[model samples]
Target: MAVAPLLVFMGAAFGLPAIAIATGAFTTSADAPGGVRWTLSNLTTSVHGAYLTALWGSVRLSALSALLATVLGVPLAQAVVTSGSRALRDAVMSASGVLANFGGVPLAFAFVATLGNAGVLTTRLHLAARGWSLYSFWGLVVVYLYFLLPLMVLTIAPALEGLRAGWREAARNNGATSWQFWRHVALPVLAPSLLGGYVLLFGSAFAAYATAAAMVGSSVPLLTSQIADALSGNVLVGQGNVALALSVDMVVVAGAVMAVYVPLQRRSARWLA
Candidate 1:
């Protein structure tokens, strides 16, 4: 009863829109004999041609960025957790929170200013001669890492801290070295959290539109960019419903990621607790 208002808000805010998208994905625009006929054509179309390419590109970018972030973040998180300085830990956590939220136009513009052709770093460091272009896929990956890496640190820090010292001591009692303890015990326990963190990062990268739009536009071919193009009739007129179908695909991918992330996070919480 106490949460009734929240439930109603959720229904209004999210449920109605989801219902609309699902309907739009399957229904044609009003016209013809019956007016707005139900069809699976949009969904089918969304998975073919340029749409498929966009979907794959988004997935590949997210996976690569998430992987790099997780690989680099774990050691950084472990270092902070083991460090004795409270101030440093607090500063890092605070900075991570700020950086993880730093995206969109300003971030894109910052990269362009520093990494773009004839830009600050490109000129000073002669990056252009080395074939570094801020408008490419790998450049976008590096830009994504600026934020995803921090997000990874924030996500895994609590799990790292939650690791009981008693477990380490017990492992040492059995003649386990540091590497052996990490391999046999720590890695197993931390695996769920690490995987969950990666999923979270992937979702963030996957849904990101503003930075990608501002930075690379359609050159890199992302689903989010495609959706925008479709919605705006940039590719062709009257593609709004198809855009909805593309959004439905994006929603499906995000839902699947959440399905995996939730269970992993719960398992990690149990182990950490």
Candidate 2:
């Protein structure tokens, strides 16, 4: 009886909305009045120029951010775990936690103040004299890394805490070098947490809106922005067509990430024990 209300809540709150959106995306108006008529046309139509470009950009940014996050995160996580005192580790961890949520419009504005044209760093370096541009794809990648790196640190830090020093000591006692120890022992144990963290990072990168919107200001489009544009004022004119299609695209991206994630998680569980 306790489970019944929970089931009903989940079904109505989550499942029902998902089904309604999925059905609405596929259905055309002709078949049943006030009912969605099923078709793949919406999805197909969303795969075009600006939409495609945004999709590609979002994916690329997400990949770069995830990679950067892993690189910066792992080291910081190790630092937090291996530190001497609980007080110091807690302080460092708390700082990273604050940064992990430091994205969206404020972050965008910060970057702009520092990295944009006529901005602090630009003038300091005289970058315009060097014929460099900071408003393109590379700029976006840098922005993503700022938000992503700290998140990676926070996510992997807990896993690092759970890992005991004995594993590495054992590997070294067996004459393993640092690289060999990490590859054979540490990585296997850390794989699940690292990969899970990357997924969260990637999803954040994928769904980012305010930062991208504020940073590039339409110079470079992103998937989330495109979706917003599609559904802006009137949801009906576009028939919510493009918006629906983009939602499906987002689902596909999430599904692809889960494909790798599920197996990685299983393998990590085995490695950790």
Candidate 3:
């Protein structure tokens, strides 16, 4: 009974919107005034040069940020999980909890304050003369890392915790070095979790908008920012529909992530067993 209402609510809200936009994408408006007419033209136009470029940029940025987050976050998670002191462990866990929920415009402002031209370190006497700017592509990568890494940590840390300490002790008793212990015992158990975590990180990075828009001011041509700009104009003219197409592109990418994620989830389950 509870499931029925949830399904009905979802269908009426998310499912209906998706169906409408999908229908609108292929078919233009003839009966509905200036609305899109149903044909291949709208989708073809949507798939053209600029949209493709933005899609590629979104994919590349997502991949790089996810990779960086995995590299940094996995280590931090391991440290947090392996820490001896309960207080230290709780503090680190608390910090990760805080970071997971921290996002949107305020996070962007925090980055700008710390890394902007007039920022603390940038404006300090020693660094001010070098003329560094954190508002460019590299800067965006930096900010993207800030958002995705903590999520990565949370995703993989549980897998790390599940690794049996006895296995590590057994390896150590056999004269295995720390590297060898991880190499032979821990890594095999953790690989599937890492892959799944990467998918989540990539998805999060690809969908991010507020931070990018706030930091770079939309000239950077991110797909999310493009969608935002498209929606900002006349609602009746329905240029907003173009943003819907962009959103469809996002849904397609997310579906691709799921394609990879489900198999990896099975693999992780097998590894755990």
Candidate 4:
């Protein structure tokens, strides 16, 4: 009873949309005899040819960006944890929380203004002559990292903070160098947290749409952009259902990631708590 409003909100927001998507994904359009017939054609089309290419492109980009973020973010989390300044830690955490939620066309526009071909930094730093292009694949990865790295810092910081100081002391007393300590004791204990953080970042990158769409247009061939194109009639008419099928595919992939992430997150929580 206490959570009725939350439940109602979820139903109206996610539940309704999910039902519509599922219905659209597996049925013929409204013009079908007796109003819509069951079919696998939409789902099948979603996984072939150009759609397949877009799906793979999204997977490659998300995986690469998330992996890079995890590698770099663990150190950032560790630094904040060990900084020994509560004010500094709080400031960084606050900033991270905001950045993690920042995306969409605004983020894309900001990057373009700062890193695009005619951007001020591009001209001043001669990045264009150096083979830099903000609308390219690697450029998108860099933009994604702007938010992903911060999210990684947030997700792993609590685990880092929970690290017992005595472990470091014990390692030191046993002559374990900093590198050896992390390679062995620290990393082994933090493995679940690290993996969970990586999965979280992967999902964020996977479902991202507006930023990719605005930044590179169809030049990148991401699944999200393809879905938008289908739904907006930018492609063949009646492809809206194909867009729905693509969304279903995205949901399945996200569901699989969450299936792995939830357990790792729970394990990390138990250890950290």
Per-prediction tally of clashes: 0, 2, 7, 0
Cα lDDT of model 1 by residue, 132-226, tens digit: 99999999999999999999999999999999999999999999999999999999999999999999999999999999999999999899999
Error of 1 at 79 (Å): 1.2
88, model 4: CA deviation in Å?
0.9
Candidate 2, 1-273: lDDT as tens digits: 979999999999989878866876787644345655678877887788778998998898898878887988798778778877899888877887788788888988888888789789999999878875668888888888887888888777767777778887998899999999889877878878788888878988898888888777668878887787777722335446567778889989988888877787676666655
Pairs with backbone N, CA or C atoms under 3 Å apart (clashes), candidate 1: none
TM-score for each predicted model, relative to the true structure: 0.97, 0.85, 0.89, 0.96
Reference-based TM-score, model 2: 0.85
The models' CA-based lDDT, in order, is 0.95, 0.80, 0.80, 0.94
Candidate 4, residue 267: Cα displacement in angstroms equals 0.9
lDDT of 4 by residue, 1-273 (tens): 999999999999999999999999999888655767899999999999999999999999999999999999988888889999999999999999999999999999999999999998999999999999999999999999999999999999999988888999999999999999989888888999999999999999999988998999999989998998998888787788899999999999999999999999888888777
Worst 10 residues of 4 by lDDT: 28-37
Alpha carbon lDDT of residue 254, candidate 3? 92
Regions more than 4 Å wrong, model 1:
31-34
> Which candidate would rank higher by TM-score, 3 or 4?
4
Candidate order by decreasing lDDT: 1, 4, 3, 2
> lDDT score, residue 225, model 4?
89
lDDT of 3 by residue, 182-273 (tens): 89778877888899999989998998888888888765767887777667862235556666777788889999998998898788877766
